[model samples]
Target: MSGDYSIYTGQKRTFTIPDYVLFSLTLAISAGIGLFFAIKDRNNVTSKEYHLGGKNMNILPVAMSLLVTFLSALTLLGTPVEMYNYSTMFWWLCLAFVSAMVLASVVFTPFFYNLQVTSVFQYLELRFSKPVRLLASFIYILQTCTYMSFVLYAPSLALNAVTGFHLWGSVAAVGIVVTLYTALGGMKAVLWANTFQALVIMAGLMAVLIQGSIVTGGFQNAWDIAGNRSRIYFHDFSFDPTTRHSFWSVVIGGSFFWTSLYGINQAQVQKALSCPSVSKAQIAFFVSLPGLILIVSLCCMIGIVMYAFYADCHPMDFNNLITTSDQLLPFFVMDILGHVPGLPGVFVSSLFSGSLSTISSSLNALGAIIPRDIMKPYCCPNISDRSITILSKVIVFMFGGVAIGLAVLASQLGSVMQSSYSVYSVLNGPLFGLFILGMFFPWANAWGALGGALTSLAFMSWIGFGAFANKVSTAKLSPVFTHGCNWSVTTTAMTVTTTLRTTTSFTGSTEVTTIAAPSYPFIPMYKLSYLFYMPTAMAVLVIVGLFVSLITGCRDPKTMDPRLICPLFDRLFPCMPEMILRPLRCGVNHKGNIRNKVYEEADELPEKIQPIDANGVEVKPPHDTEAGVLKGGAINQGFEPIDAKTPGSEECITHL
Candidate 1:
């Protein structure tokens, strides 16, 4: 019995020919999508088509693209580990997703869509100054690069654990494949590929959940077993900020984190801007919510099933079964499903798909931002469209290489979900704050925005790096048992013997070591939960920004562009009295000033407001004002200009 158990434990599954074929087919499909698009759009090598899909994408594909862009292999692999090791409190992030998407649609989406800018950071230049835009662009580049490294590293780590693939080789292969597709097909290819990958991810997750539950005797049995083992946790209402996944942290803190991604992150915002109109973009955002929730729930439930499956024979308790929690899911897949041909391939492909979608999106965004925000604006304004296209492809390839290199360094980090979130919060928090300051507070000057962002960046970096260096462990892992194992393994007797030997060697005494140990002093801020990082950083930026704005002499709201502001107060509370709304607007004249001016000007003109063409040449207005000609002669039938005094007028028309 002992020999058989040892043999069983030692033997690991390898990918069979069928598994390899299926995995290859996945890669081939992704590449083929890019190739098709590359050939189809070969003649139209303009920046607009390459970067924004010609601003003609449909709602469903764009919605799916947005969903997968942020999901990543980190979510697929790390989220399950999180649920298995900790509590289910993190599942409440579904609520955060809801609130974050709504806020993005109402606030950030309109601003980006109306501005007609190639890069989201260009809004900073228009709102503040060139220096502020440059600063933001650099921060976004750093943030996305860091995040891409984690995404690329996650699947590679899991693959190595299960399939015995060389870690760096897997990283290099995935990174190169994503780069080639992204460079070849651009935004169109990325979005379409994302749509396909999203289906694979869902199918893979469902397969795992269904199969695991069946193996565990059913989901109800799994649930009961998990509850018995104290794994079914959801009602942690603790207010302590240090509690890693309390109700407050997962919902409130997670809201800010998701908002930073969905609302303001370039990779996400770029997808929203691909739509022809703001309404379609908003629809896409809402459409993505259900799928997002499904994916997260699937990952969480998979964690529960895994815990139940290993309730007795804990994999980690066995000697060297796995080195990290992140490896647990892939190991479970191979141990359970490897015998079934193509099932392992499906799971592995899903992991790769998640990483490919995320990395490709980041690379595409980098390609767009380098030329649109930095190169064309400052370095070479007169560069031709063809040269810009070439430059963008080169930028994508270079950044992909950088991400592959950084992935090797990511191996040194702790839990993928926690470490990635910590790094993201440090940068994204400040970036989101800068956008909020500009959109909501019209009085905020460039100096204030710049000061606030820099201060927040420095402060968060200190806390983040300090916590990482001190190795402050916040996770409270659930207990595991090895008593059920039939094989000879490290047991209580071995542990006691090892402890006695260490004690004798250290203290020159044979007394047993006590359970109570000396506690080392730690910084309170350093021990702050990773969930609160974004909120803390945002608060710092806003407080410092307001203070600095007051000292630097606030920019007059009257002089500010109404198109840049979100009109959040008016949109949310339409019936609020002007007296209260004025201050809450942070000095933004959302409705009365901008709308009144446009109407006043229109009434004074004899032949209606003559619309300007795309080339800035004045053009004759269409025969009637019913279609509402925009400032640049783009006719949007959606917004018909109403009387300035009319109640609940479309104030957003001023943006057009």
Candidate 2:
């Protein structure tokens, strides 16, 4: 212990050998998984296999990977604090997960899967232009990299505060282990490691919940105490956009936010595309939803248990036990599970597992994006497959180093760390809007996308940063009591004096002076809840995009390829007349190909009948046409034969 414990609990606790061993095993197994895959697939060195598991990955592992990729250390450490401080209204975010999954599975997956592209940004290029693709790719790279750095740093900081673990050492250990496995084993390693880590994450959360419940006299008692304290709120159906965690804000705004993440973000799109078939990819997303809800519920309940344990004595108010809310969970773990030997280690391992799964997924995603989006298309078009494979692994290590360095720098950025969430929130809406514009509106050209994205970025940044600067907080914390604290004599005297001085000024009249409430500049837009940022930005982007497109001579929907457009009307209103749905789909063909557009112009047909096998190896087709097209649905099914010469090509048919 750091000798600071005597001020409060008069007990010093630290990690034991069992704890360290458990934590070490988590890291070792993750790296070991990478090594096993690296050695097993040594002979086959291809970019597709390395980045996408040759698009033949099993649904279960990929589903687990998707679940864990976005569920980072931030969610593990911060969400419990959110629940303890505010209300369980955040639980409504589960509905957002369901909505996002529905949109991703029904709207986004079919479009991307039909294209058979490496990166999701490729859709931007096919739908609009290369510049649009590059812009979106660059934004994604910046956002993910910065977010990953914070993800690596936050847990280490919390762990350092609770345990005596060196913060920088934790950062290095996680960064190195994730980089090693991701670079060596590639996507296969990432998926399996994520699956294992997901289990560890749940186990750790369960340990905390079970132990905390026992300490608080069981779950029902804890719930009753929390409910009595008004922390179990769920039906906040306020119509005001500024009301944070209200049913509308969380469900509606959260829907757009999560849809942005799952629908268009490269990390998620890459994982979804790893499956061999469109239905498999959709199934993976649906399967992940239950896990998402389970994790969120566990985190929420842990907060309630935390509140029940410290119902009378708030940790921060009692001798400043913790300097930040993020440190609360770890401190509570040490307080309750300190003597439990390996439990602390298991919890810490769970924290590290969250970071490892996230960073590994991001590293693998960056590895795929950099090579496919930037390097191959622009930097070196003639780059061979073997060379691209080598380059991708190298890029993973390089970006891993960059992330680690940024994480070290993040230690000095105290308040900026808090503001980073706002920054991420603002960007999600605009990015999702750009993709929506491309997919839904056939008239939206490249200029419109660029203009809309840039405008939304500016508009959201103004709101996000302005709100941060104004110290505008929408989530009002419930009252906490410190009357039950066993304060030291000296500290008690100092606190009494400080409290009296704030409420009364020393004047000759001996009259109590009323202190004026701090004035917050009332900016209406700035007061909008963070949850609304995504939907608001999306609206701005779509309106601006449509305006710009109309002014700049919009594309004729009839001439555009139907594969690039989402068949929204056909899917939703199947009973509607074809003539009505055709216009609603912006002239997209019902059979999934436009009659007026040649297939060759939209997507290049392969010159040989080569398709990837279950093992991710290339295999020759049994029958090949004179035009070198495979007769059957050899390319993972749902695709029709292409007629290069004719405009009525039955290519890229959707089974979705």
Candidate 3:
């Protein structure tokens, strides 16, 4: 057999002419959007315009982009497999989605919108120091790179299962198309592409759900079978730190996870920032919530439908499914929708669309951050805007190349959803922590932020990697009971070696052994579910950061930029004794009592910084020459008030 012949011996259908045509059409539409915008707006292309979509993007497209970016192929494919293998506990994360959006809107959104920074890390520099900004930016870059590789890998693996397409070919095809459009059309192209792709994703998912339900008789029948088989457990109320996917973990820990992504990660934040106003951006966040919940719920239901269809004979038996659990979604689609001609293609296109939308957003965001954050400061300090724009496109191509290259070497890392989230929770916690400390704690200093971030990262690396290495074995929860379809199904147990023969097509193994050598001893903390990593690391960061700030001496609040602190904090704790507060207090009404005693001694004070006036214009500071320049240059460079009474404003460089 070229790869594995066992899985395809029966009536299973592969890709056909109509299927390929449909898939090609989907790709063409995406590229067409990019080409249309590239030619249409070529004349007015500027760094600000390209990177932020002229900072006037509508709320609907921005909302769709946010939803699609999070609902990538990782969620589309991996989620069903998660529900199939474990249970529906993952779906409850929708609750976390609500909390995350509320926090993002109430706490993080106003600050980012008000500050008007292209790279959100610029806020870190404004709040703490240059090193903190760079560290936070680098951490974000690392997280995206790692996540994008798997995002590209996932749907390709699915396509390979059904059509036998080479994994590397799928990777290159998707990567090149995403890069082409992202480089050519920029944020507008990305946003509109996401809007179209999001629709495709929903259509494909509904098609699968309806078809699978038909095959299983009805939705209620599928639910009954799934319930009987125990594939629908959602009430894990454990508070034990090690328990995976509990009520608290999914709700509380999930909030931090989603917040890190939506609140701090530049990819999602860039979409939100593209909107014309803070209220519009907040509207986008709110608009995304319903779609996010609906899509994930559908994915979870698909898992249940799969369980019902194979109730009598699970895919694990009889070369039953594709090589890995992730492949089951594709296999199920083929079984259910193969005879429908272009329908299978639609499903596959949706998978590809999911991958394309996410990778494109990451590429565009990476492009924006490079010249703005990394390259301009170190490589060419005085680089012109034209050079910077060119550099951004180059960085997109470079990172797209890296992600594709990594896709070739990538292998299945357990269930796709778990692997991606585990990686996210472990690495992104510190990045999120830096933002939290910056916005929430006025006393937090550079050493504290840096110290806490590094410590959390180190601890998570040890525990997270250790846990991945010493993989835990869980008992299969679902009892095998196929709905008695009598068309040559097998339920006999396969020996480990025989199972490996079929699995090697996707799992890339020829011989599997039941017992393997242990690489690392199990540790109690490492055994804790990956969901807890973010909240735990965040706690460590806050506790450690506050302690270090107190001991090391915090920056004076009056000397700190009021713009860098969260508006929620300003509104909530407007006053506290100066002895208890950090010595600096920049935004307080009592500035005259403390202003000159502090700001005059601050380093690199700007000659002048015009705070935003009631009319939304940058007016000259009430007092001149004493304001310290925020570490990063004026954050709201691209956004200037278009007209008086337009409610348009630039973020002021708050000088203490």
User: lDDT per prediction?
Assistant: 0.78, 0.75, 0.73
Q: What TM value does model 3 have?
A: 0.84
Candidate 2, 1-656: lDDT as tens digits: 33124223556677889998998999999999999999999998987788888778999999999899878878888788877887789889899999899988888877676666667876676666566767888888877778888889987876686677887998888899999999999999999999999999999999999998887778888887777667778878999987767899989988988888888877788888788777899999999999999998999899988887777678777767677777788888887788899998899899888889989988988888888778776788788889988998998999999999888655554432234456677876788898889888877766678889999989999998787677775444456767656554443232211110111111232222233333456678888877888899899999999888777556556544455678886655669996677567655444534321231133332222233333333446454542222321113212234444323211211110
Off by over 4 Å in 1: 1-10, 475-477, 489-522, 575-583, 592-656
Query: Candidate 3 residues 430-509, lDDT tens each?
Result: 88888888777767777788889999998888888888777764445544533333344345422221111111012222
Clashes of each: 0, 0, 11
Count steric clashes of candidate 3. 11
Per-residue lDDT tens digits for candidate 1, residues 1-656, read 11112213344477778888888887889989998899999999988789889888999999999898889999999888887877678999999999999988887887666556678877776666667778999999999999999999999887787778788999998898889999999999999999999998998898889888877778877777766656677888989987788899999999999988998888888898788777899999999999999999999999988877776666676665677888889888876677788887899889999999999999999998899778876889789878988899999999999999999778899789889999999989899899888888776767678889999999999999888988877544456655555554454312211100101012122222223322336577887789999999989998898788777566556534456678887766779998888788665445522332232212111212233333333445444542123322223223343444433212212221
The best candidate in terms of lDDT: 1
Q: Rank the candidates by lDDT, best first.
A: 1, 2, 3
Off by over 4 Å in 3: 1-9, 479-522, 569-656
Location of the lowest summed lDDT over 10 successive residues in candidate 2: 496-505
